[model samples]
Target: MQKAPERLIDENGFRLDGRRPEEFRPIKLQVGILDNPDGSAFIEQGKNKIIVGVYGPREIHPKHMVLPDRAVIRCRYRMAPFSTEERKNPAPSRREIEISKVIREALEPAVMPEYYPRTVIDIFVEALQCDGGTRCAGIVAASLALADAGISMRELVSACSVGKVEGQIVADLFDLEDKYGEADMPVAIMPNLNKVTLIQMDGKLSRDEFERAFEMALDGCRKIRNLQAEALKRRCEVLTGTEMPEKGSLEAH
Candidate 1:
């Protein structure tokens, strides 16, 4: 077997991007962007960019898939042909199918499916760009889109990736780190309930290392949750033509 690659962390404990072990890349979110979709959102986490649109809670085609006691959740995750370094085929591959299934499961727990029985809720995620951790980023965007569309949810979902590089756990792995890291784990959480919705790990890690990485992922999820809420509030204000109250104003108080 080939020897392990060089360490991503420098002597000073700074990673290639100059981030510390616990630091996450800046994340930005925009909600209610698409005109036709019931809910839509866009997100950028580091170099990965994703757009999510939610439709239905309206009707289900194929008639047979409809549920009597709850709504069915369907998801499609696709990476654009130009999303990565190499040109990719436009057709959905096995990887895309698996991702779609996982993403649907990740968001299902937060949705109040029983409220819209006999209907279907569809989530479509498009990856406009990819560096690393695109699946986790998609989860964040899709959750926001559901909220923007006025879908009832038990809680907002947030997701982030954590990786161990050179014996240190880092939050939000970038391209280089993700490619060469010792271990990679992506996690999604329902922040209000402090419950994990989805988690997957690749590469070997000690039990202790796994616990540390998990905790780090939770912290990252909390931060992303704040950003998600802020985006939704701003979108609501924009749609209602209402200005945000001043920090010390009575409305704010």
Candidate 2:
């Protein structure tokens, strides 16, 4: 088996990547980037590329599962055949199922499901390229897609990952670092309320290190929330042919 690359330059620095101990990679997001879906978004953070599509509040099939007083959020997460270093099979694997469940649960609390009872909202996320933190990327993309669909939510959902590599805590682990790094922690947060909706971690961390990584991830989440909001505003302006009126401008109208 090939050994993982050594990523620690020294006890206190990064290897070749320019990121500091608690820095995230540059992120880019585009909303309504797809033509076929009711809502869509493309997101890139580091080497990870994910596209998400949301459809729904339409009708429920296999009708037995429809609820009487709330809509159901159905989520599917998949990796494209060439998304990874190794080609993946064309079916949803157990890992994808697990991630879909986690993502659905993460956004469930934020969605106003009672508004569309007996309807189904379908969200599909495809990993176009894989690095670390694909699940978190999926969550972020899904939130944007939902917003693009004009679904009411308590707040936007944003996510980021942090890790420990080379004995130092870091934010937003890239592909190589995640493969060889000591610990990886991914979190989804509701920035408006400073609350966490999703959290997961692997590897070892002392209490101090955990606190450091948690703080770093939360900061990243806030940064991502800003980006998501900007993307949504741009999309709305394009779709409506009008800019968002400045705050309280409607009162003048």
Candidate 3:
């Protein structure tokens, strides 16, 4: 096999993609992109692309798993066979199962499950492309899909990844950086509440570095939240023939 590439961060502090340590990849979001699901959204962050659909507040299946006082939330995250360089298997992998659980937990705090007793909310996310940070992108898209469905939510969820590359903390690692970087951390937050709902870390970091990475990730999340809001506003405007609302102002509590 050929040798791997050189260090991710250059001596001038620019990444392989020419981004600074704290810069995030460009993100685009679109809401209500599908007609069948109660809500649907698509997102492109860097080279990662994902679509999510939200359904329910409908009856729970099996009847045994129903919550007496709250709606049961289920999540499924899948990667398409062509999502990566090597065609992934069609079946869900163990990693997908774990991510599904984590994503469900992240949205649980924002959704008003108590309002829909004996019901269930199902969130499905599909990865159409992969470039690292797919989970973060999925969370952001899923949250928008939920909102588009008009589900009762305390706030929209936004997420991004941060990592230590060449001893420098960087925001939004791409596939190459993620594979070679020293550490990776992904975070999800409720933008309106200013509360973190999901945080996962890998590799290692000192306290100071961890804090720096967290702040950088949070900043990225806030920016993603703005994009999410813009997507929602655009859809709303299209339907109502109104101007776009101020960012985050349309957030429902």
Per-candidate clashes come to 0, 0, 0
Off by over 4 Å in 1: 1-6, 245-253
lDDT of 2 by residue, 130-246 (tens): 888998989988999998888989999999999888788888887778788899998999999888999999999999999989998998899889888888877878788886556
> 117-161, model 3: which lDDT tens digit per residue?
999999999999999999999999999999998999999999999
Per-residue C-alpha lDDT of model 1 across residues 98-134, encoded as one tens digit per residue: 8898888889999999999999999999999988899
Assess the local accuracy of residue 92 in candidate 3 as a C-alpha lDDT between 0 and 100.
85
Backbone clash pairs for candidate 1 read none
TM-score for each model: 0.93, 0.92, 0.93
Q: How accurate is candidate 2 locally (lDDT)?
A: 0.86
Against the true structure, what is every candidate's RMSD?
4.3, 5.2, 3.7
For model 3, give the 10-residue run with minimal summed lDDT.
244-253
